[model samples]
Target: MTTGSQRTRTVLHLPCLGPDAVPLERAVAAVLGYARGRRWLRFRSPGRPEGRWVRVPAFGWARFDAHPPSTGPDADVLIAEGLHGRLDRTGWHAVHDALVGLAPVVEAVGARAAGRPFWELPADEFSVLDEPGTVGALLRHLGQEAGPHPAHVLAALHHRHPDLVPHLTPTTRRALLPHVEEGDSGVEAVVHRELRANAGAFAELEAAVAAVVGDARPGRLRLHDVLLWLTTTLRLAHAVELGEHVAG
Candidate 1:
Protein backbone atom coordinates (compact mmCIF):
# COMPACT_ATOMS: atom_id res chain seq x y z
CA MET A 1 0.00 0.00 0.00
CA THR A 2 1.29 3.46 -0.94
CA THR A 3 0.03 6.45 1.01
CA GLY A 4 -0.65 9.68 -0.80
CA SER A 5 -1.93 13.03 0.43
CA GLN A 6 -5.45 11.78 1.14
CA ARG A 7 -5.40 7.97 1.38
CA THR A 8 -3.43 4.82 0.66
CA ARG A 9 -3.22 3.20 -2.79
CA THR A 10 -3.06 -0.60 -3.13
CA VAL A 11 -1.03 -2.50 -5.64
CA LEU A 12 -2.50 -5.99 -5.78
CA HIS A 13 -0.22 -8.96 -6.19
CA LEU A 14 -2.80 -11.48 -7.34
CA PRO A 15 -2.01 -15.18 -7.42
CA CYS A 16 -1.43 -16.89 -10.73
CA LEU A 17 -4.43 -18.42 -12.40
CA GLY A 18 -4.22 -22.19 -12.64
CA PRO A 19 -6.20 -25.38 -12.30
CA ASP A 20 -4.88 -25.84 -8.77
CA ALA A 21 -6.60 -22.70 -7.47
CA VAL A 22 -9.84 -23.16 -5.56
CA PRO A 23 -12.79 -23.21 -7.93
CA LEU A 24 -14.32 -19.77 -8.47
CA GLU A 25 -17.76 -20.75 -7.15
CA ARG A 26 -16.19 -22.06 -3.96
CA ALA A 27 -14.31 -18.83 -3.44
CA VAL A 28 -17.46 -16.80 -4.05
CA ALA A 29 -19.36 -18.94 -1.59
CA ALA A 30 -16.69 -18.36 1.04
CA VAL A 31 -17.05 -14.61 0.70
CA LEU A 32 -20.82 -14.81 0.69
CA GLY A 33 -20.81 -17.09 3.70
CA TYR A 34 -19.35 -14.25 5.74
CA ALA A 35 -22.77 -12.67 5.38
CA ARG A 36 -24.31 -15.53 7.25
CA GLY A 37 -26.16 -14.38 10.36
CA ARG A 38 -26.18 -10.88 8.90
CA ARG A 39 -28.83 -8.47 7.78
CA TRP A 40 -29.80 -7.91 4.20
CA LEU A 41 -28.53 -4.67 2.63
CA ARG A 42 -30.67 -2.63 0.24
CA PHE A 43 -29.70 -0.53 -2.75
CA ARG A 44 -31.43 1.19 -5.67
CA SER A 45 -31.53 -1.10 -8.67
CA PRO A 46 -30.70 0.04 -12.18
CA GLY A 47 -33.27 -2.32 -13.68
CA ARG A 48 -36.15 -1.25 -11.42
CA PRO A 49 -36.10 2.47 -10.58
CA GLU A 50 -39.72 2.99 -9.59
CA GLY A 51 -38.82 3.59 -5.95
CA ARG A 52 -37.75 -0.06 -5.77
CA TRP A 53 -34.81 -1.29 -3.75
CA VAL A 54 -32.79 -4.45 -4.38
CA ARG A 55 -31.58 -6.66 -1.58
CA VAL A 56 -28.04 -7.96 -1.55
CA PRO A 57 -26.94 -10.19 1.28
CA ALA A 58 -24.23 -11.29 -1.05
CA PHE A 59 -23.45 -10.38 -4.66
CA GLY A 60 -23.43 -14.05 -5.67
CA TRP A 61 -27.19 -14.43 -5.71
CA ALA A 62 -29.66 -12.82 -8.10
CA ARG A 63 -33.20 -11.94 -7.01
CA PHE A 64 -34.03 -11.33 -10.63
CA ASP A 65 -31.13 -11.79 -13.01
CA ALA A 66 -27.36 -11.56 -12.66
CA HIS A 67 -25.28 -8.37 -12.90
CA PRO A 68 -21.77 -7.87 -14.31
CA PRO A 69 -18.33 -9.39 -13.59
CA SER A 70 -20.02 -12.55 -14.76
CA THR A 71 -19.32 -16.18 -13.79
CA GLY A 72 -16.13 -16.27 -15.80
CA PRO A 73 -13.87 -16.69 -12.77
CA ASP A 74 -10.93 -15.18 -14.56
CA ALA A 75 -12.89 -12.04 -15.43
CA ASP A 76 -14.30 -11.82 -11.94
CA VAL A 77 -10.93 -12.07 -10.23
CA LEU A 78 -9.38 -9.57 -12.63
CA ILE A 79 -12.08 -6.96 -12.25
CA ALA A 80 -12.19 -7.36 -8.48
CA GLU A 81 -8.48 -6.75 -8.06
CA GLY A 82 -8.53 -3.77 -10.43
CA LEU A 83 -11.15 -2.11 -8.25
CA HIS A 84 -9.21 -2.98 -5.12
CA GLY A 85 -6.23 -1.09 -6.48
CA ARG A 86 -8.37 1.99 -7.18
CA LEU A 87 -10.03 2.01 -3.77
CA ASP A 88 -6.72 1.64 -1.96
CA ARG A 89 -5.80 5.27 -2.77
CA THR A 90 -9.18 6.87 -3.43
CA GLY A 91 -10.86 8.64 -0.56
CA TRP A 92 -14.31 7.11 0.01
CA HIS A 93 -16.00 10.41 -0.86
CA ALA A 94 -14.24 10.74 -4.20
CA VAL A 95 -15.32 7.22 -5.05
CA HIS A 96 -18.82 8.21 -4.00
CA ASP A 97 -18.76 11.25 -6.27
CA ALA A 98 -17.55 9.34 -9.30
CA LEU A 99 -20.21 6.65 -8.90
CA VAL A 100 -22.97 9.16 -8.26
CA GLY A 101 -21.84 11.21 -11.24
CA LEU A 102 -21.91 8.14 -13.44
CA ALA A 103 -25.35 6.87 -12.34
CA PRO A 104 -27.44 8.75 -14.90
CA VAL A 105 -25.41 7.39 -17.75
CA VAL A 106 -25.55 3.87 -16.36
CA GLU A 107 -29.32 4.17 -16.13
CA ALA A 108 -29.52 5.59 -19.62
CA VAL A 109 -27.44 2.75 -20.98
CA GLY A 110 -29.49 0.16 -19.11
CA ALA A 111 -32.71 1.58 -20.47
CA ARG A 112 -31.37 1.31 -23.97
CA ALA A 113 -30.03 -2.14 -23.20
CA ALA A 114 -33.50 -3.31 -22.21
CA GLY A 115 -32.21 -6.09 -19.97
CA ARG A 116 -29.02 -6.65 -21.90
CA PRO A 117 -25.85 -7.33 -19.97
CA PHE A 118 -23.38 -4.45 -19.63
CA TRP A 119 -20.66 -6.42 -21.37
CA GLU A 120 -22.86 -6.44 -24.47
CA LEU A 121 -22.14 -2.75 -24.94
CA PRO A 122 -19.21 -2.00 -27.16
CA ALA A 123 -16.04 -0.95 -25.36
CA ASP A 124 -16.31 2.44 -27.02
CA GLU A 125 -19.50 3.14 -25.06
CA PHE A 126 -17.65 3.00 -21.73
CA SER A 127 -15.51 5.93 -22.77
CA VAL A 128 -18.32 8.17 -21.56
CA LEU A 129 -16.88 7.93 -18.06
CA ASP A 130 -13.90 9.94 -19.25
CA GLU A 131 -16.04 12.57 -20.96
CA PRO A 132 -16.38 16.01 -19.38
CA GLY A 133 -20.08 16.40 -20.25
CA THR A 134 -21.17 13.67 -17.84
CA VAL A 135 -20.61 15.86 -14.79
CA GLY A 136 -22.99 18.51 -16.10
CA ALA A 137 -25.59 15.89 -16.94
CA LEU A 138 -25.53 14.35 -13.45
CA LEU A 139 -26.06 17.76 -11.88
CA ARG A 140 -29.12 18.26 -14.05
CA HIS A 141 -30.59 14.89 -13.05
CA LEU A 142 -30.10 15.54 -9.32
CA GLY A 143 -31.63 19.03 -9.53
CA GLN A 144 -35.08 17.59 -10.30
CA GLU A 145 -35.19 15.33 -7.24
CA ALA A 146 -36.87 16.34 -3.96
CA GLY A 147 -34.59 16.57 -0.88
CA PRO A 148 -32.01 14.94 -3.04
CA HIS A 149 -29.87 12.21 -1.53
CA PRO A 150 -26.77 12.81 -3.60
CA ALA A 151 -25.10 9.69 -2.28
CA HIS A 152 -27.71 7.43 -3.83
CA VAL A 153 -26.11 7.94 -7.20
CA LEU A 154 -23.09 6.10 -5.88
CA ALA A 155 -25.30 3.06 -5.43
CA ALA A 156 -26.62 3.30 -8.97
CA LEU A 157 -23.17 3.17 -10.53
CA HIS A 158 -22.95 -0.53 -9.73
CA HIS A 159 -25.12 -1.39 -12.73
CA ARG A 160 -22.26 -1.02 -15.16
CA HIS A 161 -19.13 -0.56 -13.14
CA PRO A 162 -19.73 -3.42 -10.77
CA ASP A 163 -16.00 -3.24 -10.28
CA LEU A 164 -16.57 0.00 -8.38
CA VAL A 165 -18.31 -1.53 -5.40
CA PRO A 166 -20.82 0.77 -3.73
CA HIS A 167 -20.16 2.54 -0.42
CA LEU A 168 -22.65 5.40 0.05
CA THR A 169 -25.73 3.49 -1.06
CA PRO A 170 -28.98 3.11 0.87
CA THR A 171 -27.71 -0.22 2.20
CA THR A 172 -24.59 1.34 3.70
CA ARG A 173 -26.63 4.29 5.00
CA ARG A 174 -28.46 1.79 7.22
CA ALA A 175 -25.19 1.35 9.06
CA LEU A 176 -23.82 4.90 8.80
CA LEU A 177 -26.93 7.08 9.14
CA PRO A 178 -27.24 6.63 12.90
CA HIS A 179 -23.95 8.38 13.32
CA VAL A 180 -25.00 11.26 11.08
CA GLU A 181 -28.43 11.44 12.72
CA GLU A 182 -26.63 11.82 16.02
CA GLY A 183 -24.63 14.72 14.55
CA ASP A 184 -21.61 12.49 14.04
CA SER A 185 -19.52 11.73 10.97
CA GLY A 186 -20.91 9.98 7.89
CA VAL A 187 -20.38 6.31 6.94
CA GLU A 188 -17.39 6.70 4.67
CA ALA A 189 -15.59 8.76 7.28
CA VAL A 190 -15.98 6.06 9.88
CA VAL A 191 -15.21 3.13 7.55
CA HIS A 192 -12.11 4.85 6.23
CA ARG A 193 -11.04 5.55 9.77
CA GLU A 194 -11.40 1.91 10.76
CA LEU A 195 -9.79 0.70 7.55
CA ARG A 196 -6.76 2.94 8.05
CA ALA A 197 -6.38 1.92 11.68
CA ASN A 198 -6.36 -1.77 10.75
CA ALA A 199 -4.44 -1.46 7.52
CA GLY A 200 -2.21 -4.39 8.43
CA ALA A 201 -5.14 -6.75 8.80
CA PHE A 202 -6.60 -5.65 5.49
CA ALA A 203 -3.21 -6.09 3.85
CA GLU A 204 -3.04 -9.61 5.17
CA LEU A 205 -6.55 -10.29 3.93
CA GLU A 206 -5.62 -8.98 0.49
CA ALA A 207 -2.67 -11.31 0.32
CA ALA A 208 -4.85 -14.17 1.50
CA VAL A 209 -7.36 -13.44 -1.26
CA ALA A 210 -4.57 -13.36 -3.80
CA ALA A 211 -3.35 -16.71 -2.62
CA VAL A 212 -6.82 -18.18 -2.68
CA VAL A 213 -7.85 -16.73 -6.04
CA GLY A 214 -4.60 -16.42 -8.00
CA ASP A 215 -1.51 -14.28 -7.31
CA ALA A 216 -1.04 -12.64 -10.68
CA ARG A 217 -1.22 -8.88 -10.92
CA PRO A 218 -4.60 -7.52 -11.93
CA GLY A 219 -4.98 -6.85 -15.62
CA ARG A 220 -8.08 -5.75 -17.54
CA LEU A 221 -10.19 -6.72 -14.52
CA ARG A 222 -8.42 -4.15 -12.35
CA LEU A 223 -9.56 -4.05 -8.72
CA HIS A 224 -13.03 -5.54 -8.95
CA ASP A 225 -12.19 -8.44 -6.66
CA VAL A 226 -10.84 -6.13 -3.96
CA LEU A 227 -13.93 -3.95 -4.12
CA LEU A 228 -16.17 -6.99 -3.93
CA TRP A 229 -14.30 -8.23 -0.88
CA LEU A 230 -14.47 -4.81 0.74
CA THR A 231 -18.18 -4.49 0.09
CA THR A 232 -18.84 -7.94 1.57
CA THR A 233 -16.74 -7.19 4.62
CA LEU A 234 -18.73 -4.00 5.25
CA ARG A 235 -22.03 -5.80 4.84
CA LEU A 236 -21.12 -8.58 7.23
CA ALA A 237 -19.77 -6.19 9.84
CA HIS A 238 -22.93 -4.09 9.76
CA ALA A 239 -25.16 -7.14 9.82
CA VAL A 240 -23.51 -8.34 13.00
CA GLU A 241 -24.08 -4.93 14.55
CA LEU A 242 -27.77 -5.15 13.64
CA GLY A 243 -27.96 -8.74 14.87
CA GLU A 244 -29.65 -9.77 11.64
CA HIS A 245 -29.86 -13.46 10.90
CA VAL A 246 -28.33 -14.89 7.78
CA ALA A 247 -30.66 -16.02 5.05
CA GLY A 248 -31.44 -19.76 5.09
Candidate 2:
Protein backbone atom coordinates (compact mmCIF):
# COMPACT_ATOMS: atom_id res chain seq x y z
CA MET A 1 0.00 0.00 0.00
CA THR A 2 2.96 2.38 0.40
CA THR A 3 3.98 4.47 -2.59
CA GLY A 4 7.61 5.04 -3.72
CA SER A 5 7.72 8.64 -2.53
CA GLN A 6 6.21 7.62 0.78
CA ARG A 7 8.83 4.90 1.19
CA THR A 8 11.61 7.33 0.33
CA ARG A 9 10.19 9.88 2.74
CA THR A 10 10.05 7.25 5.45
CA VAL A 11 13.66 6.31 4.86
CA LEU A 12 14.99 9.89 4.76
CA HIS A 13 12.57 11.33 7.30
CA LEU A 14 13.49 11.39 10.96
CA PRO A 15 10.25 11.92 12.82
CA CYS A 16 11.97 13.40 15.85
CA LEU A 17 12.12 16.94 14.42
CA GLY A 18 9.78 19.18 12.53
CA PRO A 19 10.22 19.02 8.77
CA ASP A 20 11.30 22.67 8.68
CA ALA A 21 14.02 22.28 11.31
CA VAL A 22 17.53 22.28 9.90
CA PRO A 23 18.68 19.82 12.55
CA LEU A 24 16.17 17.27 11.28
CA GLU A 25 17.57 17.53 7.77
CA ARG A 26 21.09 17.46 9.15
CA ALA A 27 20.28 14.34 11.14
CA VAL A 28 19.11 12.58 7.99
CA ALA A 29 22.14 13.82 6.09
CA ALA A 30 24.36 12.57 8.91
CA VAL A 31 23.11 9.05 8.35
CA LEU A 32 23.79 9.33 4.66
CA GLY A 33 27.20 10.82 5.37
CA TYR A 34 28.03 7.90 7.63
CA ALA A 35 27.17 5.47 4.87
CA ARG A 36 29.47 7.25 2.43
CA GLY A 37 32.21 7.56 5.02
CA ARG A 38 32.04 3.87 5.78
CA ARG A 39 32.50 3.03 2.12
CA TRP A 40 35.49 5.35 1.93
CA LEU A 41 36.94 3.90 5.09
CA ARG A 42 36.54 0.40 3.71
CA PHE A 43 38.81 1.19 0.79
CA ARG A 44 41.12 3.75 2.44
CA SER A 45 42.15 3.48 6.08
CA PRO A 46 45.28 2.35 7.87
CA GLY A 47 43.21 -0.47 9.39
CA ARG A 48 41.78 -1.53 6.04
CA PRO A 49 44.32 -4.37 6.00
CA GLU A 50 43.07 -5.63 9.36
CA GLY A 51 39.42 -6.42 8.50
CA ARG A 52 38.12 -3.44 10.46
CA TRP A 53 35.44 -2.87 7.88
CA VAL A 54 33.77 -6.09 8.95
CA ARG A 55 32.95 -4.57 12.33
CA VAL A 56 31.13 -1.49 11.07
CA PRO A 57 27.43 -1.97 10.57
CA ALA A 58 25.08 0.31 8.68
CA PHE A 59 23.95 3.36 10.66
CA GLY A 60 20.37 3.25 11.86
CA TRP A 61 18.15 3.99 14.86
CA ALA A 62 17.61 0.30 15.59
CA ARG A 63 20.82 0.36 17.57
CA PHE A 64 19.09 2.40 20.30
CA ASP A 65 15.81 2.12 22.20
CA ALA A 66 14.39 5.16 20.43
CA HIS A 67 11.09 3.46 19.86
CA PRO A 68 9.30 0.55 21.48
CA PRO A 69 9.45 -2.74 19.61
CA SER A 70 6.63 -3.40 17.23
CA THR A 71 5.97 -6.95 18.49
CA GLY A 72 7.14 -7.08 22.07
CA PRO A 73 6.99 -4.86 25.16
CA ASP A 74 10.02 -2.77 26.05
CA ALA A 75 11.09 -1.20 29.33
CA ASP A 76 8.90 1.83 28.63
CA VAL A 77 5.85 -0.38 28.48
CA LEU A 78 6.49 -1.89 31.89
CA ILE A 79 7.21 1.53 33.39
CA ALA A 80 4.00 2.99 31.98
CA GLU A 81 2.03 0.19 33.51
CA GLY A 82 3.40 1.06 36.96
CA LEU A 83 5.79 -1.87 37.01
CA HIS A 84 9.52 -2.23 37.31
CA GLY A 85 11.61 -3.43 34.38
CA ARG A 86 15.33 -3.51 33.76
CA LEU A 87 16.92 -1.50 30.99
CA ASP A 88 19.17 -4.49 30.58
CA ARG A 89 18.00 -7.90 31.70
CA THR A 90 21.27 -9.12 33.19
CA GLY A 91 22.67 -5.92 34.73
CA TRP A 92 19.76 -3.68 35.69
CA HIS A 93 18.04 -5.87 38.26
CA ALA A 94 19.53 -4.01 41.22
CA VAL A 95 18.52 -0.66 39.78
CA HIS A 96 14.95 -1.84 39.32
CA ASP A 97 14.88 -3.38 42.74
CA ALA A 98 16.30 -0.24 44.32
CA LEU A 99 13.79 1.80 42.39
CA VAL A 100 10.98 0.30 44.47
CA GLY A 101 12.00 2.47 47.41
CA LEU A 102 11.33 5.51 45.28
CA ALA A 103 7.64 4.93 44.66
CA PRO A 104 6.75 7.54 47.28
CA VAL A 105 9.22 9.89 45.70
CA VAL A 106 7.71 9.36 42.28
CA GLU A 107 4.22 9.93 43.64
CA ALA A 108 5.18 13.13 45.41
CA VAL A 109 6.95 14.52 42.38
CA GLY A 110 4.12 13.54 40.06
CA ALA A 111 1.66 15.26 42.33
CA ARG A 112 3.76 18.42 42.36
CA ALA A 113 4.30 18.26 38.59
CA ALA A 114 0.50 18.12 38.18
CA GLY A 115 0.66 16.54 34.77
CA ARG A 116 2.70 19.35 33.20
CA PRO A 117 5.57 18.49 30.91
CA PHE A 118 9.04 19.59 32.02
CA TRP A 119 9.42 22.16 29.22
CA GLU A 120 6.15 23.86 30.20
CA LEU A 121 7.27 24.55 33.77
CA PRO A 122 8.09 28.20 34.49
CA ALA A 123 11.72 29.04 35.26
CA ASP A 124 11.19 29.60 38.97
CA GLU A 125 9.09 26.44 39.20
CA PHE A 126 11.77 24.46 37.42
CA SER A 127 14.41 25.43 39.94
CA VAL A 128 13.48 22.42 42.07
CA LEU A 129 16.11 20.59 40.05
CA ASP A 130 18.77 22.62 41.87
CA GLU A 131 17.38 22.32 45.37
CA PRO A 132 18.38 19.84 48.03
CA GLY A 133 15.98 17.05 49.15
CA THR A 134 14.24 17.24 45.77
CA VAL A 135 13.59 14.93 42.85
CA GLY A 136 16.96 15.68 41.34
CA ALA A 137 18.85 14.92 44.51
CA LEU A 138 16.84 11.81 45.21
CA LEU A 139 17.54 10.55 41.72
CA ARG A 140 21.24 11.22 42.17
CA HIS A 141 21.22 9.33 45.43
CA LEU A 142 19.32 6.50 43.81
CA GLY A 143 21.99 6.30 41.16
CA GLN A 144 24.67 6.01 43.82
CA GLU A 145 22.79 3.35 45.72
CA ALA A 146 22.15 1.41 42.55
CA GLY A 147 25.87 1.42 41.81
CA PRO A 148 28.05 1.07 38.68
CA HIS A 149 25.69 2.44 36.01
CA PRO A 150 24.29 5.68 37.31
CA ALA A 151 22.87 6.78 33.99
CA HIS A 152 20.27 4.01 34.03
CA VAL A 153 18.52 5.78 36.89
CA LEU A 154 17.84 8.70 34.60
CA ALA A 155 16.64 6.25 31.96
CA ALA A 156 14.18 4.75 34.44
CA LEU A 157 12.94 8.19 35.41
CA HIS A 158 12.48 9.21 31.78
CA HIS A 159 10.59 6.04 31.05
CA ARG A 160 8.33 6.75 34.01
CA HIS A 161 7.45 10.24 32.79
CA PRO A 162 8.71 10.75 29.30
CA ASP A 163 7.53 14.36 29.23
CA LEU A 164 8.79 15.27 32.68
CA VAL A 165 12.35 13.99 32.26
CA PRO A 166 15.06 13.69 29.64
CA HIS A 167 17.18 10.57 29.46
CA LEU A 168 20.80 11.39 30.39
CA THR A 169 23.31 8.87 29.18
CA PRO A 170 27.05 9.41 29.51
CA THR A 171 27.23 9.89 25.77
CA THR A 172 24.42 12.43 25.80
CA ARG A 173 26.03 14.34 28.65
CA ARG A 174 29.43 14.27 26.98
CA ALA A 175 27.98 15.31 23.65
CA LEU A 176 25.40 17.85 24.80
CA LEU A 177 26.39 18.97 28.30
CA PRO A 178 30.13 18.52 28.56
CA HIS A 179 30.49 21.41 31.00
CA VAL A 180 27.81 20.09 33.34
CA GLU A 181 29.54 17.69 35.63
CA GLU A 182 27.98 14.43 36.71
CA GLY A 183 25.89 14.88 39.88
CA ASP A 184 25.98 18.63 39.43
CA SER A 185 22.93 20.23 41.06
CA GLY A 186 22.20 22.12 37.87
CA VAL A 187 22.47 19.20 35.45
CA GLU A 188 18.72 18.77 35.10
CA ALA A 189 18.21 22.49 34.72
CA VAL A 190 20.88 22.68 32.05
CA VAL A 191 19.23 19.89 30.08
CA HIS A 192 15.87 21.59 30.48
CA ARG A 193 17.32 24.81 29.15
CA GLU A 194 18.66 23.03 26.08
CA LEU A 195 15.28 21.43 25.40
CA ARG A 196 13.32 24.61 26.12
CA ALA A 197 15.53 26.77 23.91
CA ASN A 198 14.89 24.41 21.03
CA ALA A 199 11.21 23.82 21.76
CA GLY A 200 10.14 25.00 18.34
CA ALA A 201 12.56 22.64 16.63
CA PHE A 202 11.28 19.67 18.63
CA ALA A 203 7.72 20.71 17.95
CA GLU A 204 8.43 20.60 14.26
CA LEU A 205 9.96 17.16 14.68
CA GLU A 206 6.91 15.97 16.58
CA ALA A 207 4.60 17.31 13.90
CA ALA A 208 6.58 15.79 11.06
CA VAL A 209 6.62 12.44 12.84
CA ALA A 210 2.90 12.59 13.50
CA ALA A 211 2.28 13.36 9.85
CA VAL A 212 4.17 10.30 8.72
CA VAL A 213 3.54 7.79 11.49
CA GLY A 214 0.09 8.94 12.61
CA ASP A 215 -0.62 8.19 16.30
CA ALA A 216 2.57 6.31 17.11
CA ARG A 217 4.73 9.38 17.66
CA PRO A 218 7.10 9.01 20.58
CA GLY A 219 7.33 11.66 23.32
CA ARG A 220 9.12 14.90 22.44
CA LEU A 221 11.84 14.27 25.01
CA ARG A 222 12.34 10.78 23.59
CA LEU A 223 12.77 12.33 20.14
CA HIS A 224 15.45 14.70 21.50
CA ASP A 225 17.07 11.77 23.30
CA VAL A 226 17.15 9.72 20.13
CA LEU A 227 18.47 12.51 17.95
CA LEU A 228 21.36 13.30 20.29
CA TRP A 229 22.09 9.62 20.93
CA LEU A 230 22.11 8.73 17.25
CA THR A 231 24.33 11.57 16.13
CA THR A 232 26.71 11.24 19.06
CA THR A 233 27.01 7.51 18.48
CA LEU A 234 27.83 8.05 14.83
CA ARG A 235 30.47 10.63 15.70
CA LEU A 236 31.98 8.29 18.27
CA ALA A 237 32.13 5.50 15.70
CA HIS A 238 33.86 7.68 13.16
CA ALA A 239 36.36 8.83 15.75
CA VAL A 240 37.08 5.30 16.86
CA GLU A 241 37.81 4.22 13.30
CA LEU A 242 40.25 7.11 12.88
CA GLY A 243 41.92 6.39 16.24
CA GLU A 244 40.98 9.88 17.39
CA HIS A 245 39.18 11.07 20.46
CA VAL A 246 35.49 11.87 20.28
CA ALA A 247 35.33 15.57 21.11
CA GLY A 248 33.27 16.27 24.18
Q: How much does each candidate deviate from the true structure in C-alpha RMSD?
A: 16.6, 10.1
lDDT of 1 at 43: 52
TM-score of each: 0.30, 0.56
Mind sharing the TM-score for model 1?
0.30
Residue 224 miss distance in model 2 (angstroms): 1.8
In candidate 2, how many Å is residue 203 off?
A: 1.0
lDDT tens digits by residue: candidate 2, 37-88: 2322344466565544344433322223333432222353344223222345
Clashes of each: 27, 4
Error of 2 at 144 (Å): 4.2
* Per-residue alpha-carbon lDDT of candidate 1 for residues 111-194, written as tens digits (9 for 90 to 100): 544563332333322233433333223223333331233332333333234422222434444543443322222333333333
By lDDT, the best candidate is 2
Local distance difference test, each candidate: 0.34, 0.50
lDDT of 1 at 7: 21
